[model samples]
Target chain A: MTIKLHCFGESGNAYKVALALELAGLDWQPVFVDFFNGETRTEDWRARVNPMGEVPVLQDGDMTLTQSGAMLDHIARTTGKLDGDRSEILRWLFWDNHKFSTQIGMTRFLMNFLPEAKRPQPVIDFQLGRLKAAYGVLDAQLKGRDWLVGRDVTIADLSCCGYLYYPEPFGFDRADWPEIDRWLNNIQSLPGWKHPYDLMPRAAAA
Target chain B: MTIKLHCFGESGNAYKVALALELAGLDWQPVFVDFFNGETRTEDWRARVNPMGEVPVLQDGDMTLTQSGAMLDHIARTTGKLDGDRSEILRWLFWDNHKFSTQIGMTRFLMNFLPEAKRPQPVIDFQLGRLKAAYGVLDAQLKGRDWLVGRDVTIADLSCCGYLYYPEPFGFDRADWPEIDRWLNNIQSLPGWKHPYDLMPRAAAA
Candidate 1:
């Protein structure tokens, strides 16, 4: 049975797992969640699909999973590819969720998705400052290394790179971060690597 | 060997691990990180401690672990307490990191820790809205349950409850969320449970 991923393109959290599945060579299909239309916030969607009301919920046979970090770990653990030192990988995954992707995801949504007049400028500015600090941390860690964790690419790399591939301006400029830029290139050069927009069906209008 | 936790009381992320160590009956000592004094951002601190420049780093024997979610898993795995369904536990742990505590941690810092004049009003209002949604999700999940996962309290409980126990307000009022309040009570009822401030040395001035 092919694994089903309930996701939308705008969510970098969802893209993390999709990229992992594709790169790991797993049989997976995308079921788009109309996040722009407030589908995730609906009562039926919350009750039936996810109580957390978030995307990137994966169903593989009897097991239904949410949380992109956990899904990435599951894909890596089951496939035996893109797997590495568990503790180290988990550390980065947690950091990405706590400090990296989550911040970027919200900042991107505020900057690009929300109506220009409705956008909170002060909030966006604050987030951009925070994001700059987070980017510096990632760049510093990537200095003298190709991947976030170990010599080979792992889910840690996949998790952190989720929001970086998008074209939307979330106050991140790859040219400004050379180490991160090179590290992203390393991920892009992977055999089956695909941009997030290419890997998942986007909810945003082209 | 005694575990050394590099943490400060103000960080809910650190409290998650400190609570776990205390509840797990581990011999642990708190090594305070002077976050307010800008210790974590220093080059020497980043080079010697965590490159992520965050707290709640656990050092036991030769192993040094950062990220509270990873450290919680480590404590649960090694001590055999607060362990539950791996996927279920991880799902909440990831959710807490990505949504629950991280948002509250930042919002609380902005609202309470930062100088009142320096606090950005728009950012606080925006974060408060997002936090209400997160609180609803957590409250709905805990509606009829004693804990976030399984029949007993686990790291998921510790992780989500990290910021909830704080005295400082970040727009969260226990009375406003009955389900979450009850769930917090259940965690409080746990034997050997200690408040975050009680478990770690506080860096902020009272």
Candidate 2:
């Protein structure tokens, strides 16, 4: 059965699941959601697709799953790939959702997607500060390790690296954090790894 | 063996785990972490306690667990309580971390905990807007449901209701959200349920 991922290219959250599917060599297809046009916010879409008004929804046969973390877990568990120390993997996944990727996703959107005049400077600045702290934590965790969790790459790595591959400037620079830079390189070196835009159909103009 | 939860009263993240432990009828003790006094931010604490530099660290004999969502899962699994449809429970837990509690936690800290002069209006306004959207999603999910996941209350309920129980204003009013309000009442009605402040030792003055 083909796993259908409802996603847009601009969404790192969606990209996390897409990357997992690709790396795990699962049979999957991308169904682009027109998120930029407020499709997700509409009552019809929310009622039919996801009431949370978020993307990265995965439909595998009778199961429809939202929340990229949950989707990643599902992929890892079902495929027996990207699986690691369960507790460690889950810890990083929760942290990424709570502190890392969530901040980066919003910050990137505010910095790049929003109109220049409408961009909230103070909010961006605050997010940048928070993101910096989160980056420090990530870099520190990666200081003497190859993967965020166990001895091998896991869903934890995929979850944390969700927004790092983006070209948009969201107050993050690879050169600034050598640990994260090297970690990103490690992820990029994986077989079948593809840039998010190459892997998913993008809704926003490049 | 007794479980030791490193937490403080002000942290809603910690409250999630605390509430789960209490409701599960586990023999647990709260080892207060002085969050406001910069304990979690210390180098020693980060290295020794949690590299993520966050709270709700649970220790049971040889195992040390961080991340409230993961801890909730651990509690539910080990105690045979608050466990339900694994996928549905995880979906809501991820959503709560990514959208609901994280925003409310930060917004509440800025609005009430921070010095009035140091509060950034734009950041607070932005977070309030995001929090409102999250509240709408949660309220809509609870429209005709007694719990967030499954037929009975699970960690999903504990996770989402973490920040909602806090007295600090984070632009969330239970009165404005009737469904969430009623759902909260259902949680409060659960035996052994305690307010966050009551369940944990608070570092801040009430």
> Model 2 over residues B117-168: C-alpha lDDT tens digits?
9999989988888888888888988988999887999999999999888887
Error of 2 at B29 (Å): 0.4
Please list the C-alpha lDDT of all candidates, in the order they appear: 0.91, 0.91
Who wins the DockQ comparison? 2
Clashing pairs in 2: none
Kindly report which residue pairs in candidate 1 clash with one another.
Answer: none
Which portions of model 2 show Cα errors greater than 4 Å? Answer: none
Q: What is the model-wide C-alpha lDDT for candidate 1?
A: 0.91
Residue ranges of candidate 1 with Cα displaced over 4 Å: none
lDDT of 1 at A68: 93
Candidate 2 has an lDDT of 0.91
